[model samples]
Target: MNRIDVHHHVIPPFYRDALAGAGITAAGGRALPDWTAEAALEMMDLLRTATAIMSVSTPGTSFLNDTSAAVELAQRLNDFTAELRAVHGDRFGYFATLPMPDATAAAREAARVLDNGTADGVVLLANSNSEYLGTGGQGELWRALDERGAVAFVHPAELPAPEVEGVPPFAADFLLDTTRAAYLLVRNGIVRQYPDIKFILSHAGGFVPYASHRMAIAIAADTGRSILDILDDFRSFYFDTALSSSLAALPSLLAFAEPSHILFGSDWPFAPVVANQYFANGLDTGVDAANLAAINHTNAQVLFPRLAGAPITTSAERPVVRLRHTTQRAVARALFKLVQPGTN
Candidate 1:
């Protein structure tokens, strides 16, 4: 299967040096892994991944205290990735980094890279300096992305809360962080408001498919909106199966997500090659051939039409067997009771 990995990460030399200079040698409670273009290509070849959409992972530009420094680092990282793509155009694409929480600077950077074809899209951390994506004062950034009809990859950052002793943020907290951002986007109407910008949620939307109906109820109660309408908005976000392609998670994700919204991801280098292979194997065994083909590449072609260099087969061309709605709701209800028993 030729897959398009939307969740691959890039670690530029300057980024590593900057982190080292700041006495920050770890990200998401893990030591940074060495990376190179050759290695990434080799991994892709091993996994049969035809293309990788690269982005800088967590703590993106947020580690820099100065707005100018953050902006500059984002530009440098983006430029470096663009150069890589220029050389290996068929094998790689990149999502530009933006210095968020500094909304104005982020907006300017988004325009500079996206307008000039320097990026396939942009990557935004779930939160920057404790300011989440759907929060206020980010109208400029949203508008800029919306105007371009850009694809924004929503990656998780370290949680704002204090870490549990001996627990890594990426293990569990990252999921919650992405879920929080997705909820806020739907709650605050950013998903609906910025209709043009396609938001790709990493790590299988980080518990979103499992908890969506429950969240929809909460949003409906707070906003006086229909739960079905809120759920529809939640479903609008794209989901990439990165570290989340296990057999246990696939059913809920495949059931809740729109057919074309599920995309393949490897979370490579950050996820380690062994882990990537493990999950990729799980996905291979969990879904039928046709559905697997869609998650691997066909659906991705619809989003990134430029990747349609050869004859493209879409998911609509095959028969997909999805989990019944009754089963999905039963699972959701069980999970809801376990998580929040007293809720209506």
Candidate 2:
């Protein structure tokens, strides 16, 4: 399969050095992996990935306390990735990095890159300095992205909470972190208000596919909106299969997400080549021919139409058969009990 990997990551030399300078050597509880354009292409070839849309992973520019310095670093990283894409147009696309928790600066950077065609989209940390996405004061950035109808890849950062003694943030907290951001986006009306900005949730949307209804019910209860409407908004976000193609996860994801909203993802160096292969194999064998083709590349072609060589089958073009709300509610109740055993 010539897969288009949407969750690929890139680590520029300057960014790595800055982390070291700040005494921050790891992200999401793992050491930074070595990355080069050549090495990335080599891995892509090994994984049978035709193209990889790259982004900087967690802790993005958030490590820099000085907003000005963070803004400068973001510009440099974006320029570096943009040049890489310029050189390897056939193999690579990139999401521009931005200085966050600084919405004004982020909005400016987003416009600069998107207007110039230098970025496929932008990658946002699930939170920056404990300020989660969809929080107040981010309207400037959201408006800029919405105006462009941009693709925003929401990758998880390290959780704001203290870590458990033996658990790595990436192992579990990352999922919760992504889930929190997704929940806020829907609950705070960011999804509804900025409908044009396509949001791609990484790590198969963390716990989203499994807990969506539970979250939807909460949102409905709090806001007095219909649970069905909230659930529909949850489904509107896109999801990527990166380290999340296990038999258990893939099935729930496939059942919960619209067929066209699921895209292929390989976390590359961060996930190790062997792990990437493991998940890819799972996906390949899990689905039938047509569905496999769509998950691997066809579905992504709709989001990035320039990549499509033939006729495209868009989400709108595909038949959408939603699960009945009553059934989803029943399953949600069961899952809620499973995850929250003591709850009423």
Candidate 3:
């Protein structure tokens, strides 16, 4: 369909080069994909995506570990992204990344970026160097975003844990990372206090949907609040269908998430073309017409009014281009099972 991708990644030349210079080659256990404006357009055309909201993926300039360096890099990356949006306002938009872990610097940059209209929204990693968002330290940043009614895209990053043998962090740890951030935000009353800020959780909220009741029950017991109240907080955040539009995951996401809260996300570049296509195919096949239309087009237009929209397109109306990699699909299913942290 005419999709608005809310979870696409952009690796600008300077950002990519900076990562290389730091001897950091991978993000969340996946090799960084080669990206260019031309390449991104080509993929969007293939996927029938009309507008892709870009964000810097994991291991952002936060790896610099120096406040001054992180601040400088955040500005550079945000400025470059803003330039792209300025030039390609129709085809592209961006979520500005903050120099996080340093909440003060992050809050300052957030104000500057959002005030100048340099970004459509801001992208925050679930945790920056083990200091998760939504905690007391980040109250200032949350307040800044809340005051502006800002859209915050909570993307996953590598956690502070050692790697598991034969398991990719993107598949498993990233899920827990997003879940932890979501739990913290809800548990600590950040969502309630900062009600104006809309937080979009990546990877269908990373097991939060399926395990939400467990979280609610635990928190209710701990806080002596009603389970429904905790559940309400858990459901307050938005979810993107990046790497999660499947029979297994989408069902829970659709069931648990408010219908209007689910947004389309390709996780492109990081999620290779084949993988993106696989999930797109699942979304096409699994959802009904109206829901598909909402997820792909209408919901995004509501979230980002400035982004232009086109007529809804569906695989049913067009020639079906079937996914070619059956073997890869099988492998993906197996990996998905391995990475479901809440299951065990």
Which stretches in model 3 have alpha-carbon errors above 4 Å?
A: 308-344
Among all windows of ten consecutive residues in candidate 1, which has the lowest summed lDDT?
312-321
Residue 157 C-alpha lDDT in model 1: 95
Query: In model 1, what is the error at residue 164, expressed in angstroms?
Result: 0.5
Per-residue lDDT over 62-162 for candidate 2, one digit per residue giving the tens place of the 0 to 100 score: 88889999999999999999998888775888999999989999999999999998798999999999999988999999999999999999999988888
Kindly state the number of residue pairs that clash in model 2: 0
Tell me how far the alpha carbon of residue 322 in candidate 3 is from the true structure, in angstroms, after superposition: 5.6
lDDT per residue as tens, model 3, 146-220: 999899999999887898988889979999999999998988899999999999999999989999999998888
lDDT of 3 at 330: 70
- TM-score for all models, in order of appearance: 0.90, 0.89, 0.91
Model with the higher TM-score, candidate 2 or 3: 3
Better of 2 and 3 by lDDT: 2
Residue pairs with backbone overlap in model 1: none
Candidate 1 per-residue C-alpha lDDT over 40-132 given as tens digits, one digit per residue, 9 for 90 to 100:
987887777778999999888898899999988999999999999898876889999998889999999999998898799999999998999
The model with the greatest TM-score is: 3
RMSD of each: 8.3, 9.2, 4.5
